[model samples]
Target: MPKNIYFIALCLLCIWGCRESASKAGANKKDSINKVVQDAAHEIAGNFSDQRSLRFSANRLDSFFTRYDSLRTFQKDLTTFYTERNYAFAWYSDSGLTEQASHLYVRLENLPEEGLNLVLPYKHTLDSLINAANTQTLEQKSETELLLTSLYFFFAQRVWAGLEESATQKIDWLMPRKKLSYSALLDSVLKQGNTANVKEPVYRQYNLLKEYLKKYKAIPASSTTISLPGNKPIRPGDTSPEIVKLRKKLFLLGDLTNAGDTSSDTYDSTLLTAVKRFQRRHGLSEDGIAGAGLIRELNIPVPQLIEKIMVNMERNRWLPTDVRGRYLAVNIPEFVLHAYYDDSLLWNMNVVVGKDVNKTVIFAGSISQVVFSPYWNVPASILKKEILPGIQKNPNYLEKNHMEWNGPDVRQKPGPWNSLGQVKFLFPNSHSIYLHDTPSKSLFQESKRAFSHGCIRVANPKFLAQYILRDDAAWTTDRINKAMASGKEQYVAVKDPIPVYITYFTAWVDRQGDLNFREDIYKRDAQLSSLLMKR
Candidate 1:
């Protein structure tokens, strides 16, 4: 052959060789996928048929459900799921179990990272069934099939939909719990496999936090606290050996895009910026100080943070599916009130929630009236605990506090000196908890702001009032201010009731997709965390 002809022949040979190798790789990949199903069927050796099929009907499901009573509540739903397919085999085939079943098995086994404590479906029997060590009779196959379906329901209920309403109520989480159709979900998952929205019902925050959970899990737990000698704050410009450690810590947390120069031990502006980012994310003062509080926050194990993330994910499950209309959401732990219109967040502001003694109840209500120059009705407990003492000290306590007796109960006159400030947004509930302006505006500046008697004290009361009254042509800013200044009690009913949801969440992802960890000011996280880690 000529030189050009020889070169052409060599190229063709090389191309053919590459094609042959690619074909082999493709076959290997397919085999591996099928192997997952094959291995599972092999484990659960049975008097199996050549064609994979279900041995039981919907009527037989009840008998099998007796073995997994926890799944009794979902028996009807599970039956519908299996019945949809005329009770055909879902997991297995003549060759082996289907790949979707294999996917579900892996997903169920990894529920721990999702923070589930329940025993898995077919815990011991699964191993023997998959490996063919234990022969599965027709009846046994039917039982195992129903059991796996029960576990799927369990996963959806516990991980995605959350615990029963009674359980959530026991924890005092009273927001309208999101309702999910597990029957529909089961049907979708079985038909579509991994493409189904298994994690769809969950809040976006759950998925966002899961990313951080994986990253945090990769980080080693810090047993020792990042202590500073004399327990002093590490102010900006201070040179401490801890600066290097802090840089790496912040970097791991994604506060610092780059760790910057760690060679120099000085607390430079670069690291200070990172420290401020960390502080801001955690709802702390951005004072550029690595103080004892910051050190304590830093020392919290990544695993603990991951648990917090998971705990909050479960809480999100309790939230409603749609919050599109105008409403107010106050996160007690974050000490912030988020205002939404048409499901879009308009803005958020600092709020003073109830202390541990008088926790701000987590529930939903409607803001029906904006009470301008409203009287502060003293609760019986406060009267005995705080007011009775005041009157005991001063004979003119009622006059001094601008309070007057209204029947048996006393109320403070609305003014700048009033506890309820210029205005109060009323959301009629048994708890009598509502959002109101406070005379003490300075408290809003504090990083930790939980000093209320079961109600929320909004920092930007005027702004909140403006937002609430924007739709009503009758209430202009000037007229609203006049009403507030009149110091005479007045009530204006809202034509459109705005829903108010007071929630308690210690951890949530922010608008910027950054994870935010707020201090559990009401000390609720400990109890909830204990409940979650019960396994």
Candidate 2:
């Protein structure tokens, strides 16, 4: 063969080998690109698939790259806007954007990358707002701004309402001598920006709340001693010489004698009338008896009475504002039940609360129903501890009291001797207690009676039932009595659930501004009074 021919054949073989290698390399590159595209598409769709053929003619890689670049630019711009120091510009520019971004983030959190495209705009806006808030100033802000900031922080997991409340309490504590009203103090403290971020406001609010709590706990002690002028004896019609002296001491009748009444006996009518008037004014029974009870009332110094009233007023403020409107109120200390309609007293009656061992709790609930001639399903505690033991000792005890045991449950049928009289007001509460009439009429006669087992026992329950059932046209007083006469258990559901509040109050101002003091059965007033003084 010729030398030139051999060289040309070798060159052809080399060219063929290079062409084969290039073809193999190109196939591998295509496979690698396809994998990248597939992975990216899965991430975007949040699922597995082999649908690459769907975009057979389009470049998926290029599209994904474009979106990725846009996201990166958005994040960068948000960071810059948030970090800006100018409050006005930062807030104005980022507020709307942040809200939008927050919505997007929420939408995105539940969606796959494929759905991310739908809420991309919202995500961008949220990011911008968050960044802007991060750069906000810690200096004192207006109350409105502070509130907004606090709300944002609350939603953002940066602060809690408890912390804010604690901060408010602390502020109240620190300013012991400061007479700033609660509203003013709240306004001032809340105006100081996010307390979680700004330590000063947090501390201030905390101190205020602590102070209020302390005040609520400190009750001022009063001296129970009464001073009488040498224990002089009194004559009914003869203004006793001591009475004349007391009149001078109290400055009641400036001259101590009226016209044509130089004789002590002749002036006794004026003195007795004056004493009765004083008794009524001082929340006494107005029996006009100058005995221990009346003496105690008269001896209470004016300044001390003022202090008691102030303490009670402060306590009223601590109560929830929603206590307005129609509601039934049971004053535990007074041993009385009052139904108020639009803040006006609708009904007032003597009540017997729980004894010291079984005290009535203070709470609120709605009266759901009324039971007429209702069987008393005695509580297990009472049945096992009281009734069962009594019955075991006396076999006829159950029959005598109209009670019977069905397995473990003791049922009491309505009768004259039934513990719960003819009517029972059913108010559903967590305490499982209700206000009902009791057969023990003598208990109501006592000045201070704590006789029931936690449930309130009303003196005139028939009157209460009559008042409550007034709305029901068919349920007349005669009808109620007839139902009770039948001796069968009956429940009458009320159309509207009336609000019932069982509370304890030792001191309160009457309609005529007279301060009334009731026996604190639970002794809550003393504790509450102490707390108020502490503040």
Candidate 3:
């Protein structure tokens, strides 16, 4: 065996023996373990890696895997990781452990802040080494080197890469997975001394949710539930004993900025504003009413909310980091379409998503075509299940609907009463789903707008169209309206296709830094929560 490798083995054996003796010592166990770690760290003598030049042997690197067999899954990655550095020690220097080493250890210890509850391999050993404060010897430095590498991989995979691509596909997430180069990321971290670059592999939302996770975790448990008197809705200026409890709940939830006089029962303007903010966050009708719905949301335990934040964090992990620049995102659960430019949300409008029976798929594509006065080509499935049956029930069903036969298929003529309204945004996919204007604008008024067959129903399609065509000076707002009202189906090719993401984020942090939660309209939260638990 190589000298450093042999030395590491001997020191580990002595440390284990001393740990056993300490376990029997009871009162002095912690002291004995600390002393043993410090002693072993000083005993092994060899030239460790320096600040500018790393000097660990590749032969000893092979022995590292043989010793830490549990981390064998990372052998290929660790090999490539070292080969990229010409067999350099990543977490140490000639003087002592590098600054990045301590930072990594602190972050690893506080993994829960990243919405993870992972029990890392050899964590106790790493803990002892980090606590020793002086890892000068080659054996200690080399062991630290390999362990840090393994832990880095573990952290990167869970916190950044998230679940495997196949696993996300099984969960019906067809969005492109964020491709990461772990070796390159580590190089940046080591060279720049900016561990913040670790966040580059995932979407920005992941870090936002991570920040909220820490805040949510620190929230004290509420022993009492906020309930309305006789389940009656309380409007502004209404007075009731329940209002007192409501104020405190809202304060703790970050809705009410001030809980002035928690004993007061009057529903003042201060409380009214908070109620509306809370309602908006919960995807409710923001009428500033303290109803049973708002009370129920307030009563939800902090731990459950924490779990929700964590679940959405996992979903954020499954997203491609390239969704930035300029894009349109439709959050299914929130029933809203958000237009973003360069990571800044420009505007948003209400949208009706697919019902549970015909659930919309989670995916991404580029909007290449916008059809004005779109003909509602009745799908074959809809034809067989709905139109054909309607025709059988009534002979004049087709004529009444302004439908005519084209070959073997049926299509509604482009008109005001057409099922697809006057416009449709197309992003061709196998699911045949797209965003289109809806005649039933009343559906958008509902709190839960999941009435579509599978495609999205945009409440403000005209405005969306104008925004999309803003770059083309010839296609003005008046031109877009004229195109829609022409009653002739016109397909306009987009000059620069905009990326569109159909995502299902039931919980997210908004631009105002306030946390928002929406209903899991398709009941996907439970399924995702189960998967996260198993992970």
lDDT of each model, Cα atoms only?
A: 0.78, 0.53, 0.84
lDDT of 3 by residue, 312-339 (tens): 9989987777555789999999999998
TM-score, candidate number 3: 0.87
TM-score of each prediction: 0.83, 0.55, 0.87
lDDT of 1 by residue, 134-156 (tens): 46677666666666677777778
Ranking by lDDT: 3, 1, 2
Best by lDDT: 3
Worst 10 residues of 3 by lDDT: 43-52
Error of 2 at 63 (Å): 51
**Winner on lDDT (1 vs 3):** 3
Please give the clash total of every predicted structure, in order.
10, 42, 0
Clashes of 3: 0
